[model samples]
Each structure stands twice: as structure tokens, then as C-alpha cells.
Target: MNPLEIGSMVKARYKTGAYIGRIKEERGKFYLVEVLAVLKHPQQGDLHNPKETEGVFFHERRALAHHEKANIPKSAVSAFTDDIPDYPASLRTALQQLREDLNGQPASAYRDLALSNMDSLEKDYFG
Candidate 1:
């Protein structure tokens, strides 16, 4: 596809998760994406010190709120050919998927903490 232009619907990878957004602007090799829907929320915990709970500041990663903007790399942005889902519904689906994926894993502090973080985010997002 041609280079994504401003206002193009796109799937973008910010850090650990993916999102659906519209290209709001271009900055060098990155796209300033206005978040429309979340595909996957970022994994919880210290990204810089992955899986290191001891003495590490475990983070509560939250999905970008509806209409929030993030700078995503050009290489990480791709055309989203499918029709966009409404933001609230899309977030619900993404969170459910994350919960299922987390529950399928072996029990660990990280998993439990992640689930807790997800719960907090859900309450904030939906309340």
C-alpha cells in the first residue's frame, strides 16, 4: 500500500500491544495516531525490567483512552482494511482476550499482578 496519509485508519503497535487508530499527523518516520480502538492492551509490569518483580517498579499499563494520541513508528503502523469497531466495544473485547490469555498461563506473581491491573483499568474504562 502507499504511504499512509493523514486521517487513514490504521493498526499500530505502540509498545507491547496493538491498537486501531487514525493517522492524525506525520512526524519524521512516525505517525501521530489518534486512538480509536484497542486491539490489545499493553502487558503489565516493568517493561524495562521484564518479569523482574524484585525491586522493580511494576507498572500498571493501561490502554490508550478513546481519542488519545500516541506516536507510533512508521514500520509499526499498517493500513486497517476492516471497518472500525466502536471504541468501548473494542476495548471490552481486547480486555476479555487478555484475561483469557492470562488465565491460561501458569500461576505467577506477574500474572496475578497483571490481572489485578487489568481489573483496575476495566473499572476505570467502563465505570
Candidate 2:
């Protein structure tokens, strides 16, 4: 793969979320990216524990704000050629998708916990 140039738009996985952003700088094995839109909302609940609800801290993970910068590993970044969606619209879509995916599953504590966290996140996002 060709090395990505600085200022190029990219699709990147940063932690538990995916984002569309522009590469700001390349540092060793990482690229500094400026978030333009969210492709997926960050997963809630303890990262290490994943879907567990018992004996673990449930958490809220917000999508990166527009223009927010994060250092993402090179392997997680790829060129994004499509038109960038508006941050608000993209975030709402991602959140709705996650909620729907959870809703599709048979009811479980993990699903319930994730849905509950999404509810709070939605409230905070819009209000």
C-alpha cells in the first residue's frame, strides 16, 4: 500500500469507534488524525470486559467531536474517498444502527445495559 499523505481524508478505527478524518501528521507507526465525522459510535461498557454487565463498570463512550485530534495506529487508517457526512447526521445514524443491532438480539443483560447507555448518550448528544 502506498504511504498516505498528510491532509488526506481517511477512515480510521480509533479504540472502539470508527471515524472519517484527515491525516494531520505521521509519527513513527501512528498517524495524527482530525476527526471529521463518525462512522460508528464508541461501544459502551468496560472495554476489557466487552459485553459483560455483572461485576463490571458500564461506561459511556462518546464519538469524537468534529475536529478532535487523536493519534491512531497506521494499520487502522485507510483512505476515505466518499463525501464526508455532517458530524451530527453521521453520529445519529451510527447511534441508531448500534441500537437496532442490539434490539435484534434476544433480550440479555448485555443488550439491556448497552441500550440503556445509548439512551443516556443520545440525550446528552442532542440536548
Candidate 3:
């Protein structure tokens, strides 16, 4: 229930499956994740909630983040499965290139690919 549990997983309404990231707190408010991968929003194809479809926003709230908040709705959240898919080779290459280009440019570019198995990426790239 604690959003800032450091190594907890969570599912956001926008993302189809779940996310694996460390929880972090800033300015007294807790964030569900410290690092999350880009995912296709659940409402991507839906005519409703255009904002979610456009991929402009990504993130889900955890109970710890809003435990005392009354304005936010309380709901059960799902944790991401380790069996996610990794990004395609083409996309991965492009992302690496982009990161190299933007290296040391103030912005930190980290790659978060969704793969059914977490080891897929390492085996493909690192192996």
C-alpha cells in the first residue's frame, strides 16, 4: 500500500499491463515510480479520454501517494508482471542512437522497454 516502497510494481489506468519501478518521494508527495517505461495507454483506441489515447501522459497513483487525500478516488491497483515484452530491435536501436546524441545534454534518457520476459532484452543485447 505504500507507494514509496522503493521496489514495488504498479499498474496505471493508462498502461495496458503494469510497471516495474522504484518508488520515490518528493516535496512530501509520493510518486508511484522512479522509472517507468513508455506504454500504450489502455484508452488508446477508445473515443473517450482523448488525452489518454494521445500518449501524452503516463503514470498511475498508489495508495501511499494519496492515502490522506480526499479528492482522489481509492481503488485497487495491479502490479506489473515480469512477463512483459521487450522493444523491437529497430526501436531499441533508434532509442540508443537518440540517447547517444543527447548525451550529457542535461536531459537523462533512460530506455524502458516492455517485454514479456525481463531477460529478453539482456539476452538479445547483452548476449
TM-score of each: 0.95, 0.95, 0.28
Name the better of 1 and 3 by TM-score. 1
Rank order by lDDT, top first?
2, 1, 3
Residue-level lDDT of model 3, residues 1-127, one tens digit each, is 4443434554433233222333343233334443344232121122333324244333321112212211111132345656433334333443344334335344321222111122343354446
Q: Rate the local accuracy (lDDT) of all candidates.
A: 0.91, 0.93, 0.33
Using lDDT as the measure, name the better of candidate 1 and candidate 3.
1
Point out the higher-scoring one by lDDT: 1 or 2.
2
Q: In terms of TM-score, which candidate is strongest?
A: 2
Ranking by TM-score: 2, 1, 3
TM-score of 2: 0.95
lDDT of 1 by residue, 52-104 (tens): 67898999988888999998899999999898899999989999998998999
Model 2 residue 102 CA deviation (Å) reads: 0.9
- Cα lDDT of model 2 by residue, 19-127, tens digit: 9999999999999999999999898889999988899988887889989999999999999999999999999999999999899989999999899989999999998
After TM-score superposition, the amount by which residue 47's alpha carbon in candidate 3 deviates from its true location, in angstroms, is 9.9
Clashing residue pairs, candidate 3? 83-116, 84-115, 84-116, 85-114, 85-115, 85-116, 86-115
